[model samples]
Target: MSKKLTKNKKKYRDKISHNKKYSLEKAIEIIKKTNFVKFNASVDIAICLGIDPRLPDQMVRGSIKLPNGIGKNTIVLALVDQERELEAKESGADYVGLDYIEKIKSGWTDNIDVIVATPSVMNKLSILGKILGPKGLMPNPKMDTVSTDIKKSIEEFKYGKVFFKSDRYGIIHSSVGRISFSNQHLLENIKEFMRKIIQSKPSSSKGSYIKNVCLSSTMGSGSVSLDIKNFD
Candidate 1:
């Protein structure tokens, strides 16, 4: 590593020790201090779990309507029929259409935050899976991003409904709130998110599921260990 990068890492390490685990409030407070960027950065939580992710029954995936919406702009792409197109746009879908399907077919998915589609249109999306699947943009009914109610889905997503999934490493990483939000709001969101995660635990694992939790900022300043039971 370069001398400057090492110096910056030392700066953060000075503020926080590696072994100390902080409470929920203290962790959120430290998270704000780590934002060195000019823009209002996102506050994220990374939960490391103990599970065999390759097992069929050990997958973790869910969505939540955060108590306080994520402060960043959420762009939604809605795929629906003629009747629902107007409602989708009215509900704040950034892009809506059959034309979107064509655009996506031609490899044009850009600047999109979330994708919402009706059941009728899901059948037509087989071709775009390779494009959208890797990005987690493919709509799923379990995530509440796929439905017949275009308006509700669009509204929820527009208001910061977050979808999360654990990776092969048995870790679920997602943004909980923005730095601009009140500390109490951030705490509440974190608690709710943790509750959802704990509820979604796979029964087959049988060991300690939540192995570790940490809070940090998008720009990477303060990464603080958090006690799992504090949020529980």
Candidate 2:
């Protein structure tokens, strides 16, 4: 059975054409205009890739520092030794030290957006993988969430560096900016994001790496597809 759309959602749906693909600029405009939610809605981009995620060789994933930061402030948790705690704190980590490991062990993982850990403390954190892994909070070397340079890692994350990975469906979804952002900022972010994804394309993947790109707001009734040619 189809679920009923709310009056507001219906109004939003009426504004969108399901079959048409829009330019990134036009799509951003539509997303901002149709965002009926009272609160500022995040503008998210979804890039559907032509890859078999099940085949690790074909996976595409990496991180990028957007030219225009996503509107949300990141709250960083640094899991480091005592000597590095001050470094982490000075670098903008909201929470620091190994105690949070115990806190995490006791189900105290709250108010933290990213977790950065030093090489020395990774062994201590290894036990909590079961708790943090599924949450995408577990510090990993590949994402730079685990590093010897605690300060740099913490600062990068606290500033704007965000990680992205392909889901089982081979689509990558990330927040480029908020509806309040100017069209230029959103456009640049989306382009840069696409460039970053393009850079991470696996050699094993063949033909038309990106299937389609779409943009949608937090409460938008439907996504506005984009002309993939623009990114190329």
Candidate 3:
């Protein structure tokens, strides 16, 4: 880190108390103030679930719509044939064509945020795995990113749809919205995500599904701990 960034981070670090876990509202307040960047930093949520991801039954992965959207008008890529290209575009998909595979092979994937692929086209994408897999942009049948309903999938992601998959450590992390959004919007997004997570709890799991929950911004070096207020 540069001396200036290091000096600035030191000043901001003192504002966030490592020992304290503020309630959701207060945590959001702190997260807003802690952002020192010139651009609007994305506000993100990270939840640690108590499910064994190793077990097929305990894996938690799904897509849900955010009430206020994920802060960005995500650019979506619909990998379909010539027939569905126009249909995909009409449904609000930014980039729609069967050329996605060729684009991937040529390293032309730059602005893509998510990809929706038809079931038939997915088999041809095996060669692009090494390029797309690590980026989490690969189409997956489980997440419904690979589907025959091209238009619906395009519209869903064009609006406010987000797909999340837990990491090896059972932590599901995603950006809820930007710092410019209202507290109500951010709070609603967080609550909606947690609600889905709870509803998706594995019946075979033995402990609390939501082991721990917190919210933090992309700017601050330290975590802005959140102690969410209990709800029924």
| Model 3 TM-score on a 0 to 1 scale | 0.86
- For each candidate, what is the lDDT? 0.87, 0.86, 0.82
State model 1's lDDT. Answer: 0.87
The residue-level lDDT of candidate 2 at 178 comes to 87
Tens-place lDDT digits, model 1, residues 116-156: 99999899998899999998899889899888888998998
TM-score of 1: 0.93
Off by over 4 Å in 1: 1-9
Q: Tens-digit lDDT track for model 3 on 69-139? A: 87678899989989888899899998888876787899988799889999888779999899999998889
TM-score of each: 0.93, 0.93, 0.86
Cα RMSD (Å) between model 1 and the true structure? Answer: 2.3
| Alpha-carbon shift of residue 17 in model 2 (angstroms) | 1.7
lDDT of 3 at 124: 90
Give the Å shift of residue 177 in candidate 3. Answer: 0.3
Tell me the deviation in Å of residue 32 in model 2.
Answer: 0.9
